[model samples]
Each structure stands twice: as structure tokens, then as C-alpha cells.
Target: MTLPAIIDALQCGTFDREVLKMLRDGGYRCVTPTLGFWEGTLESLDSLARWRDMERENAELIRIVRRADDIRACIADGKLGILLGYQNTNLLEDRIRYVELFADLGVRVLQLTYNNQNELGGSCYEKEDSGLTRFGREVVEEMARCGILADCSHTGDRTALDTIEHSPGPIAITHANPASIFPHARNRSDRVIKALAERGGVIGCAAYRNITPDWACATARGFADLIARTVDIAGVDHVGVGTDFSYKGDDAFRAWMRMGRWSRQLNYGAGSASAPGAVSKPDWLPSADRLSDLVPALGEVGFSEPEIAKIMGGNWLRLYEEVFG
Candidate 1:
């Protein structure tokens, strides 16, 4: 049977022709290349610079997705569609207008916070979640108005629930797993998952080792089983894959992702302080080239072909249509 077009909801890394080739080989026709802003500053020139770089460097191999139709068009043309996304609203600084500005620049996804509290709301690691602040409510409204998805991947439980309650439209938790499966700060709870799904939102399961049950449960099959369980909770229509793959290997990149100038000391955010580096990924899904293995793995987990297709990519496509104009 022919597989459906695949869309990764969130991946963090640089994009180049080689990466595009791997995505194409993996049967991924569309993906969200999420870049993060950590400094909590209004200067988003760096994000713009990277967007321009991807446009210039891989113009032939990939096309930036601005509209829902662009995804299918890019896939039919054999070009990977890049859905520009941000993991934090720090780039917005204090101005709500920047939400529309970033949307004009083709940013389709925006997470309210990262691993720490921001102007919008608190993070999962915060001592106490402040929930959605007044500014956060304004940002959510503006994002919904501008067709930018409100993401809650790194947001605290209260903030995430608040987003679901206050947003005019559905919101997404783009890269997370179930806390019930693996008790981690980065994972979502059943309450959050059900609320998101009830609001017409989708949840993308992450492949990060720390979010999985253990090193043994980090395989492609294991990830598939996780998705299966998520489906049981959130329904198949609201579950998809967000690998959260960071294609960087340098120590600086690792440290930046963890601390990102937010702390002077080493903050082992996800993994252990002993390592503070990239954790070992499953052998079945080390990179985008291995993403295709998920299809059969999902089948092995007893998902019907149509259900597997939705988990593979259809659900996210529907979400983009509803949220991204």
C-alpha cells in the first residue's frame, strides 16, 4: 500500500540541501522547522536571518510553506515544504503586534514559552505556573487572528490548560509525550491531552529519550506504542509525530538549547546533568531518514491503515488548514 504524505510537527535544527534530501528519502513532504528565541528580547532579526538562509540555500530542494495548499503542492513537486515555527514567544518581547509581524514572515507556529517562564506565561520547570497572564491572553487572541498556531510544548500545565481555555481557536502541544507513560516535566498530562483534543487541537508525540519510559522504550516500535496510547487518550484524529530532532552535534548548540543565556550555570533541562549533551536516540529513528519506519511500526501496534495515515500526517494537515491561513 502506498503511504500518505508525512508532516513532522516540530524539528529543531539547521536546514540545507542534505537535510532536504533526507526528508525526501524518508517520505516526508512537509515539516515544521522550529527555531527558538531564548533571550526574551524583541530582536527577531536572527530568526529572519535563518529563514532567509533556508530560502537561499535550499530553494531548489524545499519551499517555505505559507498556506495549507503549499504542503500538498510541494509534496507533489517532490520538494519538502518548510513550515516555519518558533518554540517560544520571547521574540515577541512585549509587543502583541509582533505576532502578526512574524506571521507575515511565514511563521505558522508559536509556543508561548520554552523551558522557563516568559512574558506570556510560566514554563514546565517553573516553581509555580502563573497560568495565562493578561499579556498571554492578548498574544493568544492575536495569534489566532493572524493564523499562527498557539503551541504549548514547553509550557507549564496551568499555562497550557489556560491556553486551551482562553484561545479563540484550538491550540497545539507540538512536541511532547504523555506524563502518564513517562513522568517528566516536558510531557503532557491526560487532562491536558483531552482538553486539547476537545478543543479541536492536536498533540504531536516526541521522540526524546528523556520523555520515553526508558532507554529500552526508545525504539521506533516503542515510540509507535506511545502514539497508540496517546491515541487511546486523545483520539487518533488529534495525534501526530513531532520528532523534536535537533540536527546539531556541537557542544555549544547543546548548551544553547539547554540554557540559552537564561542561566549562568549549567541547567540540564531535559537529560541528566552528568551528560548535559545529546541523549542517544533510538536506532530505528536516529534521523529524518529513519522516519519512514514509523508507518509499519504503527501498523504493528494495531492501528488501522486509515488511523495510521492520520497519525503519520493527515491530522497535522487538517490542523494547519484550520489554524494557518
Candidate 2:
């Protein structure tokens, strides 16, 4: 009856005491929270500094994960591993060398683009899919050298394919669903999923209701079905769960996430501006802690214990070992 060690591929918030308790009580061994979304270099540095202070204060509750072994260490100590990540490369700006700087600072995953095009490449929200630019190719090369896992969660399809083809190692679409099941611009197509698996990448199926076909009405079984569809294309080893849970955000923070000082007007990245509020989570899996509830739901969809273990956490552990080791 014991549960496997769970590593959430993406949880969207700066962890506070209550959030850490929720994750710990909920049985999460590790969680990847973005250090920089739309933040620049100085801002990201500040964020990391704050995290260091948090770790120092709550050493028993959580520890920062630098290597793949660090994840195991956290589990052994019964502490949550904070695998530092970035949802965008805006922190890099025009400087490709910052890849190493961030890597040295304990950042293990970096997303190429958010909702808009940057120096690296095009985003899903871009009017024209620019693919991976020359600068973006250079950034990918630097990321390989730095040993940081590349993520294309919010990137354009062409750009995601280009990243997979260009990277020396496997990349990640750490938080996204299959567009085949639900045709949102933020979702990945079957072509992208197949390509990702062929290149040894992992796609962490997200639980954000706005991206699902059922929207706010999605049930845990429906989310499991989405994972099942992803497994059909990518196989179980190349898929996992990224609930995309955000705890410490009001409507203002939500607005900042969608339109990060980029536009004077509201730019609803996934939701419509007309219906302005935070996107609703599924009733069954409302928080990251409820991730364990999906176990039976996955089973209902015919996933065996080992396969459910892989989808819950083992596959992501393998990926972290290969890429972060």
C-alpha cells in the first residue's frame, strides 16, 4: 500500500511554509518551481537568494536539488527537493553565457520561450512561428554545455521540433498536454509528442483546466485519459505528471503571469480577457497535494502499477538522472 516517491515536473509558485507543508503532507518528494518566469537577471538572482534563505531556515522541510543524487538525498532525509527551474529564458536576455551562470546557481531546467518570442525562438502565441533562430541554436548549445535540461512547454511546434533535433541530449516539454486530445495552442500535437519520445524527451501532462477540452469541468479520470493518450503516443517512460499548481497567487499575480509587463493591455495567454480571473482547476485534483488521488484514476484507464509509478514519478527521475547527472 506504500506510494512511490512523487516528483512533480512543474508546480507554479514560490514555496511558503504552508505550501511546503501541503506538499510534504501530500507525499511529494520533489517539485520543480520556476525561479524565473518573466524575470530578468537581477530579479532571478534575488529570487534564488530568497530561496537560499528559505532552505537555511527550513532545512528539515526542504532542500535545494543540484544533482540527480540530490533528489535521492532529499528522499532519504524525508525532505522535499526543490529542483530550480525557469519558465522562460528572458533572464538570459542577449547573453548566452548566463546559461552557465544559472547552472552554477543550481538551475537545472530552462524553458526556451514563454508565451511570446524572445532572443531564443518563437512561442505558441506568436503570429509567425520563427522556429529556432541562430541565437536560439547557440543558446541550445550552451545549455548542453551547461548540463541544463531544455524545456519547450510554451514554444511553437516548429521551435520545439528544432530544439529536439538540435540538442545533443533529450529535452523536456515539462508542462503541457496533447493537442490531439484537446486542440489548444498551448497543447502539443501528436507529431511533437512522437518526436519528443523518439529523441528521448519526456512530456509532463499538465492539469490546467483551460488547456483541457473539458476546461473547468475536467475530472480526474479525464485528466488520466489525457495522460493515457500521451502514453499511447510517447509510451509510459516518456510521460509524467506536471499538475501546474499555483498556490500563492491572486488575480494580480495571475495577470502578471499572463501579461508580464510586456503589454499595457491584458494578454490572456490561455484564457479569454472577457472572462477575467484565475483559471479554474479541476474539482478532483485542485492542488498539488491531490496528485496522489490520480493513482486510482490512472489504474481505471488500465495503467499497471509499474506504469503508474513511471507516470507519477519514476520516468521524471530517470530523465533527471540522464540530463542532470
- In lDDT terms, which candidate is top? 2
Report the C-alpha lDDT of model 2 over 169-286, residue by residue, as the tens digit: 8999998998988888999989999999998889998877777667323677877887887899999889998878877788777877888888998677787756567766778877
Q: Residue 149 lDDT in model 2?
A: 93
Badly placed stretches (over 4 Å) of model 2 are 215-217
lDDT of each: 0.85, 0.87
Off by over 4 Å in 1: 39-43, 215-218
How many clashes does each candidate structure show, in the order listed?
0, 0
lDDT of 1 by residue, 50-160 (tens): 777877787777888888899989768888888888788878879988888888888899989988888889899998999999999999999999999999999999999
lDDT of candidate 1 at residue 274, scale 0 to 100 = 72
